[model samples]
Target: MSKTLPPAPWTRRDDLARLVAALGIENVRWVGGAVRDTLLDIEVKDIDAATPLLPDEVMARCKEADIRTVPTGIDHGTITAILPTGPVEVTTLRKDVSTDGRRATVAFASEWRDDAARRDFTINALYAHPDTLEIEDYFGGIDDLAARRVRFIGDAHQRIREDHLRILRYFRFQARFGAELDETAEAACAELAETLKGLSRERVAMELLSLLSLPDPSETVARMHRLGVLPVVLPECCKKGVEALKASIETERRESEAPDPIRRLAALLPALRPVAETVAARLRLSRQQRERLTCAAERNEGDVADPRALAYTESRECAIDRLLLQGASTTPLRGWDIPQLPMKGGEIVQRGIATGPEVARTLRAVEARWIAEGFPDRQRVEAILQEFLQKRS
Candidate 1:
């Protein structure tokens, strides 16, 4: 008796079957996250296969089959097969020759176990034959998966040392899958936490945002703070920040909204625009992202009484962020299409106001009144403009 790959939509694809045929079904096995997720009944998004076929050979075979191929990560032995379904990566089995706590220099190997050994986690190293659907588990990945435990491949310390980004990845996977923490893995992560400094901020930001995007990452984030990991990466975050994250999660649940990582990241920082801006800059966030983070951090008490006004003033997104973090009702903002002010500066100018500063000031007065009156209709806006003009006269 042998373990079989679980049945799923991805397994029924004719294009995938053709891909396996092109590479010789016996030469390749579906590997990594696709195998891991499918077995767990998680919807598989990306498909990857491992083979002894060299990258060039993989490309040549696909070309003969009339399937296009991209030499994505060719030096790392990965070639992307463009299928009608989606791009699937076919990589040669590899063994690490050297690692610098950030990246690995690898040599292609013919053994599946060699490649599996180099992966970050046991659950991620499971493989399944394309034709037989029989699983090849060199480690106790199946048992670990059943237990909902996230464990490193070999020595936890050695695995983290091989790629320092694994420090953050450990918490992320644990947040997504683990029920009980693997103490050995946890200890290794705690000890090697400093090694995360060597990783690119972009890579760190990607992993952090991913973790936060999960349904609820408050507990995992608090654990990271306890283990001395969060401070090393984001010192701006404090105990209060973790508490704010908890509040934010509760509000998202209340509002029936999806988890927002950038908004959550804002919650995990002090409520100072400068602090949020600083963290945003350090994380290399985009201009829009930096603005959102800063906006979420700065709470105006006046806005709390009227979320729509805040939405009109700043943005619907920023208004939602403030409301959720403030433990206020996002109900007012939900499904409500933000409306534009019905009057413009040109409309004010037509009312005998001068073109320069006076027209701008009167237009602002009319817009403010319209917004304060709940984004009234065009007729009402005309009335508001008249009132402002009479007041100025």
Candidate 2:
């Protein structure tokens, strides 16, 4: 009951496999994305092994080999076993103990059948032995993977109730599979769409962003919206910026040089106010990705043309963002870099006859005038400041 391993540039290494076998964990198989990607002819990113070994036993064996052991999800019977080449996620087979639409409560199982039955979809349930290269498809996952159909493992509504995030994952799989959504699965998603709101914003945001990067994100996004999912995660997903981003993803896809996920999200920013950034901050995007999202959002306001006008608007990042939306290569903001102000509040105070708002007003007027004149070098800029100050005096 074994199969030959596929020819991948990267395969599970021998040293780790030998160690795991030395532990005597039965029913060892490479499972999940690693197997699915191998079938899709996509490069394998990482390896995860399912075993019947107890968590403590796996830990003991790893310790014996001097392999780095981490309780990545010890509560769920998963251990992160690190090897020199790469890290492997080793987990015991488990069945769900309970679920409340957001997450599952699981108890480790003794057999592969029990474990495979609890998975979300059929295509993901396929497992492969890294060494013997044996594939175990308990749910006909190999056939489904070959056919590109993303059929749920069991009752669609039951699966959604177990984990609402599966609703988004369903769409992502559809994109990855390049297959039409199964009729039953689509209906079940619509029936339970409202329950998706119960999921965490971070989870929803991650899934939605991934969904948008798919070949036909527009189809999935519009479908999710129709089924009442997008609004709960991002109320702004329906705005002009969102549509623009959707269009941009397709345009970029056509170019044969697809942008990475962050750039794709950069194109899909919801047309939002500065306030929306507060929501983004709350959603917990990475600092760099958040900055990109914020930069794009800030530039969403209005167009910039004049050099001095750029002074009133945003920074170089934002200015460049607006120019990108216009299909331009560079921004006018780069065309004129506004130097730091030479005149200080103290200088203004020394020239001021009062401590009222008028001093501020006069300085702004002078600065605006100078910008309109095309900000000269440091010396000319200083001269312009002096002229304004003299007038104020």
Candidate 3:
């Protein structure tokens, strides 16, 4: 079946075009994400070449061409070849010999048609030429891509059985490509979400985070919740966070700045009522992210009474905290900490204050005075602290 491509003239870097041309797609086609992103007019990442050449043969050909090839998953018939242009992933055509839902056992095949048949989605199954710019669609991927819809290549349940991660990818496709999902697709995703229970948290994290970092993350997550994918993956991700984030778009340009999974995950934290430790442990977040999210959520636990709270809870994440405060209270995210206290502990010592409870009391008084003074300069603060220390003494 013929499939429609995204637009005119797919773009390819010259060196990659030449390196890929060497392999020739006579038996295989360059396919998958590159083709999909090309259709969307977005820059492609990790170029993949589908070939009929066996993994071993592909390695041989690549070596003969003086191109570096990495057996990234040679056992699965996928080899990552390195060229001066960039890293090109070369995956052989394979049929899912068996699938445990959590993982699949694939036996490499020599036919692109059979290989395309084994893939999950029509959009993902389409292949294109980097040189001649010819698009090869075995399924209706071209039409679906045109319609901005995400439908499995064959039976939705069957595809989900092959790999449960496709369930999350269903939303990822929807968010990234603005694809409207069908009933069968949503059902399949919901049905397979339970299978995610047995899958690795790291894998689940990767897919969930990809969905969260998209342009329309809130919408995608809302859909995932409707499909019941939320509790299965990020259980705590729900309406409150979505609502808070919706109006706070200006809080931070997080989508562009902190584009990583951890930052996205952090943004979701303040929306929930769970404690930082609880959220961290449940999501199986990394130590660093767990701490960051915990801190961000804690900072949001109370009203921003003064800059001291901001300085204490959000010293590092001050920008995000400020935005949240401004959104919630119509206040500005910008606030200032009192200037550095000019007087040190020695100044108190020199003032002849006893080194016990009085010293601690005097320091507190000075800090309070500084904050009340609204962050005055070092000279003023020093003079004030000296006067206060003498009074307390």
Candidate with the greatest TM-score versus the true structure? 1
Best-performing candidate as measured by lDDT: 1
Q: Candidate 1: which stretches are off by over 4 Å? A: none
CA-lDDT, candidates in order? 0.90, 0.71, 0.69
Pairs with backbone N, CA or C atoms under 3 Å apart (clashes), candidate 1: none
For each candidate, what TM-score against the reference?
Answer: 0.98, 0.78, 0.82
lDDT at position 122, candidate 3: 88
> Tens digits of per-residue lDDT for model 3 on 176-270?
77556678988888877788787787788778767766655767776777777877776666666556454444344532234344445655555
lDDT string, candidate 1, 126-231, tens digits: 9998877889998888888888999999999999989999999999999999996799999999999999998998999999999999999999999999999999
Q: State model 2's lDDT.
A: 0.71
Ranked by TM-score from best down, the candidates are: 1, 3, 2
> Model 1's lDDT to the true fold?
0.90
lDDT of 3 at 376: 75
